[model samples]
Target: MNFPDLQTERLILNQLNEQDTSALFAIFSDKKVIQYYDIDAYQTESQAQQLIEFFNKRYLENLGIRWAIRLKENGQLIGTCGFNSLNEKMKHAGIGYELAANQWGYGYASEAISKIIELAFSSVSPFCELYRIQGDTMIGNEASEAVLKKLGFKEEGVRRSSGFWKGEFHDLKCFGLIKPEFKAL
Candidate 1:
């Protein structure tokens, strides 16, 4: 499937490219931006390059897609978001997203997520069809939880020591939204 660019009133979601490497690194390497994320703050632009490549490869393989979020007015990259791993046969996929610290509390994350949810649930291709969208964040990440709740996801439970990253285990709170729930939103 080809990657599709999405737009909202204040933001645009497009494929990550070399031009975005620096801005992408800036967000990922910031302490506040990745505070609750499992991975360590990126230490080099090479990591961002690898990440861009990874995102594109995921799309080429029909596994998932990640869109770089930018402001509509100034065209500045603000964050990244999209479905992570996808299970086409099961009609489910995991959602992941992050934004720059300076861009917090402005509803950009929620807006971008809502748009992606609508597209994901509405797309009907064999590979793009998704019945359920799941988001798992570090336990105690209230900001992420709020975003999920605002978008109509229901908290299922916390998986104890579910995520192993950066040499330690972390609890993950799971949130899920089905097609019907998204439609109601």
Candidate 2:
């Protein structure tokens, strides 16, 4: 299937590429942005390049897609949002996202993620048969929790010490949205 580009009122979610390394690096290297990302802040552009390659690989393998979020107004890439894991046999996938510090508090993450959920649930040929999409955030990440809640994801439970980050294990608060829940929205 062809990689799709998702659009919202103020954002365009497109595939990431080499040209996006600098912009992505700028966002990923910021402490505020990566605070709850469960990964260390990038230390160089090469890491961003590696990330883009990883994203492309995932797409090529039909495992997931990580769209580079761009503001339509100025064409500035502000963040990314997409599936990070897929289980076709189980009809579920894991969702992940992060936004630039300057783009926070503007509802961009929610808008972008809502679109991804919409795509996940709609009958769009070979691309939309998922029955559930799950997301997890660091235990104390209230902002992420609020975003997931606003988009109709119900918090399931916490996975104690499930994620290793910052040289320690961190509890993950899991949220899930089933197909029925999404259809009822």
Mark the regions of model 1 whose C-alpha exceeds 4 Å error after superposition. Answer: 123-127
lDDT of each structure?
0.91, 0.90
Per-residue accuracy of model 2 over 1-185 as CA lDDT, tens digit each:
67788899999988998999999999999999998877888999999999999998998888988899999998799999999988888999899999999889999999999998888888882453799999999978999999999998999999999989788999999999998988787
Q: Weakest 10 consecutive residues, lDDT, candidate 2?
A: 120-129
Screening candidate 2 with a backbone cut-off below 3 angstroms (N, C-alpha, C), the clashing residue pairs are: none
Specify the poorest-scoring 10-residue window by lDDT in model 1: 119-128
Off by over 4 Å in 2: 125-128
Model 1 agreement with the true structure over 6-106: per-residue lDDT tens digits: 89999999899999999999999998888898779999999999999999999889898899999999999999999898998998999999999999999
RMSD to truth, every model: 1.2, 1.1
Q: What is the lDDT of residue 120 in candidate 2?
A: 81
Tell me each candidate's TM-score.
0.96, 0.96
